[model samples]
Target: MIKFLIKGILRDKSRSLLPVIVVATGVFLTVFMSGFLKGIFNDIAELNAKFNTGHVKIMTRAYAENKDQVPNDLALMDVKKLLSQLKIDYPDMEWVKRIHTGGLIDVPDSFGETRGQGQTIVTAIDMLSPGTHEVERMNIKKSIAKGSLPVKQGEALISDEFAERFGVSLGDKVTLFGSTMNGSMMFNIFVVSGTLRFGNTILDRGAIFMDIRDAQLALDMDDAASEILGYFKVGVYDDIKAQQLQASFNTKYSLKDDEFSPQMFRLVEQEGLGDYLKLANSAGTIMVFIFVIAMSIVLWNTGLLGGLRRYSEFGVRLALGEEKKHIYKTTIYEAMLIGIIGSVIGTGMGLGAAYYMQTYGLDVSSITSNIGMMLPSVYRAEVTPSLFYLGFFPGVIATVLGSALAGFAIYKRKTSQLFHELEV
Candidate 1:
């Protein structure tokens, strides 16, 4: 019976052809679309990590609120101390780094090469414990195109784009000047140590790196850091986890009874970086809708034909004393086969597409002018296992299997009515 069913399906090549093609196309689209979304999210994650935030950052109360607290005051230095003590207690949160940020500065033609103020950006950083901010520092360092990192207070690292923006080369003497946190005048001479390119437009265009000491002194904060940056292997992007880890530093400093605002949690999601998160979510939802609508049409049409054509065969099976359930199961098996085949093909195609896109980011600059973004426009698909599960596999299986079962519903009738279907 099974062999005969196979032969019957194979004999009607034209009827079966579209179904297979539909399955394959649907599967392929699911995988391809999912991988694309995953890629975009990953790129955004990387961008955020390199330029703005890590998995999470702990900022001072006023800083997150933008209420204008002292620019360089460490509102939570006690919290950092508590972190050290908490590590002794919990041991799980041994990794944490303090990060301080300050105003942008420009190197003048007075010191050396003539990159005007508009062309250069200098940012001050402080090294906490010579330990923290090291890994990120290295990552930030490698992105540099030329010149070495500035280890001492006087030295500085300039991004490659800044180098090109001002047409300055390595070893160029640049004068760095910026307002202190106290609004006092500040100036320092820095040798261009390295050129940097971070794949982030803002960072690439106008960002400079200096030792934390340089940042603190340049900003005239004097041992006052903006926030304590920390590192941990897990529990990133969770405010509750941060609150729990705050216990690890218990002995180092006292934790106030005060509650931290949701804004205090500096996860990428909470920071509200806009489309960095929104576009990803939107794409995922959009893909699902498209897949459903697309698959529905494909399945409904295939099911109708597959059902009507097989009606006579089903009637004959019933006449031969095959149970209705048995017929349904057989049809389901056929649907499963088509689904499996389509899913395999789709996954393979989707992976290939994703890999290609990852290597060459989609250039949307041609349309950016039309869309009008203040930032440079680039889009890359983000791929993840979740995306795969959501987009490709489920859609194919549900559509194919459901379609096969739906096809069998057309076979429903009394044994006396079997001849009627056969006659048609």
Candidate 2:
């Protein structure tokens, strides 16, 4: 019986064409919007992970409290040993140590006198690790506008904007003047190896990148780190998994008696991030909801239009001794067929477009540079499992619901009235 109904729907263009088109259009929008929004959310989360926080981060209890200050005094001790143990225990995750500090970069002239000065936020990460693609992962190499990656000791990368502001260039001798973890003044001379632009206003303004070993020596924090960042193999943030990991880690390393205990934090739990992530997710939900509601109304109206056009057909069926219920059920089955066909076509179109967007993202660098936010310039679509069936929810539900409501008129028509109405 279902096969017969599908055959009838295929043969009857008047009954199937408009509804199929309507459903396809609605589902297309649904799939496209969902993928687009997912892309934006994932982009924001990934950028956050790459630049500031990872999926999970481990910090000293005191440092977590005063994290905004980038307090190196409460940095983790014996970081190398802890990292090695973590690698052995959790091979699925990649962990890296980082030191965050601030200092004055002085570009010296031929006479060794200060030619330019700029305050910088210094970040130190593992550049020499043969096993890790930290430089590529962070996109530092791609962001470089001049020179190349640091290849030797005492070499560093400064933000291109910072270099321009300070009248500095590649291979320029620059001296970093900052205080050590113990409150003693420390200085390190480095030759600028490259100029990079991260597209982040704050980071690009006065950011300096150095090798982790160099930072450790200069900051007087040997074998210690301000924070340890951990990421999953997928290279995307998973809030639920991060929370679970944090719970498990914190439970095992309870701070009951120790004031200097290490604490684990999910990406969203980091400073000033919880609200931002929440807002972004909430906006995506609202967008999907809006699409569903709008599509439902559109398909609903299409169903009503199709039902009205089939009024005479319904009357003729009832006149031929067919039950009103049977006619209504047939209409629903036909709607289902249309919904399925439309959804398949629409999902295919949406996925194709999404793949394109994902591969070659739209560049928004011009706008991002002026906003002074930590947003990436390229916006790409992120295709997920939901993209396959996301359209079906709106397509089937809206079509079936609209048909069910519109088909109610069949029950109201008496046999005599149906026959009389069948005339013209």
Candidate 3:
């Protein structure tokens, strides 16, 4: 019976061609949109992880509350000792130390007088840490706009925009003046080794990156760091695991009833990110639902037209003593086959497009520059397991649902009436 139905559909283009095209087109769009949105969210999360927050972070309670000030005085002391203990305690995760501070960069002319000066946000990164992949993880090699990464002490990477504004270039020596952890004056001379462009407005405006040892020496903050960042082995954020780690670490390390005690925070806990991510996920779900409803309505209308066109055929079958229930069931089986075929083809095409987008993304530099947002130049699609089967919900289910609704008309067609209508 199924073979006969398949053969009939093959012979009749009107019964299969248009419906297949509609279902395939709808499924293709559904898959593409899912991948595209997932890509955007994933990209943003990674950027935040690398630039602002790690998968998890540890800092002083006072600094966590007043982090906007870049409070070096509240930084963790004896970082090497603490990190050693942390490594032994939690060997599953990678750890990196960082110092955040604010300072003034003074560019000098040949006469030793200041030529230009800018207020800058400074980030001190571990340059000589053994067994660390911070450089590769941050993509510092690719983000370099001029010169190269710093290889020696007293060298730093300044933002391209900051360098341009100060009329500075590679090999230029500059003075950085900042406050020490003990509320004392601190200053150091640094040669500009590289200029970096992160494609982010915050970094481009007035940012500086320096070696951790140099920063510690300049600030007189020996063996101290603003925060200790933790990353997963896979370099991806897992909310539940991160939160669990944070809870365990805080419970173990945090001092109770002490304002200066250190505390741990998951990526989602800091900067109100938990709410933002939840909202973005909800928005994606709403978008998928909207697409499904819109496609279902369109397919439903097409099914009604196809059913009306088959009125004569149904009448002939009814006059020949075929049961109405049997005719209805056959229509459902035919719709199921069409749904399967269309979904398979559409999913393949969508995945191919997604892979292309993932490899070579669309450049939106102009858009990001205009908005002054922290966005990358290229936007890519993310292909996941969900993307592979997400289209099936709308493709197979909607097609079958629309076809089933249309088939209900089979019951209203009386044999005598249909024969008279057909004979006329």
Model 3 stretches astray by more than 4 angstroms: none
TM-score of each: 0.73, 0.94, 0.95
| Residue ranges of candidate 2 with Cα displaced over 4 Å | 1-4, 272-285
RMSD of each: 5.2, 1.9, 1.7
Better lDDT candidate (1, 3): 3
Worst 10 residues of 3 by lDDT: 366-375
Per-residue lDDT for 69-148 in model 2, tens only? 98899899889888897788667789999999998988888899888888999999999768766898789988998999
User: Which stretch of 10 consecutive residues in model 2 shows the poorest summed lDDT?
Assistant: 287-296
Tens digit per residue, CA lDDT, model 3, 1-424: 8999999889888888888888888788878877877777777777778877898998989988889999989988878988898898888888888999998889999899999999999998887666658777777878899999898898999999988887897999999988988899888899999998877788878888888998899888888999989988777889988878888888888998986777888988877778767876787678668766766677677778888888898888888878999999998999889888788777887788888888887888667864565666778888889878888666888778778888888898877687578876
lDDT of 1: 0.59
Candidate 1 residue 321 Cα shift, in angstroms, is 4.6
The C-alpha local distance difference test score for the whole of candidate 2 amounts to 0.83
TM-score of 1: 0.73
lDDT of 3 at 159: 92
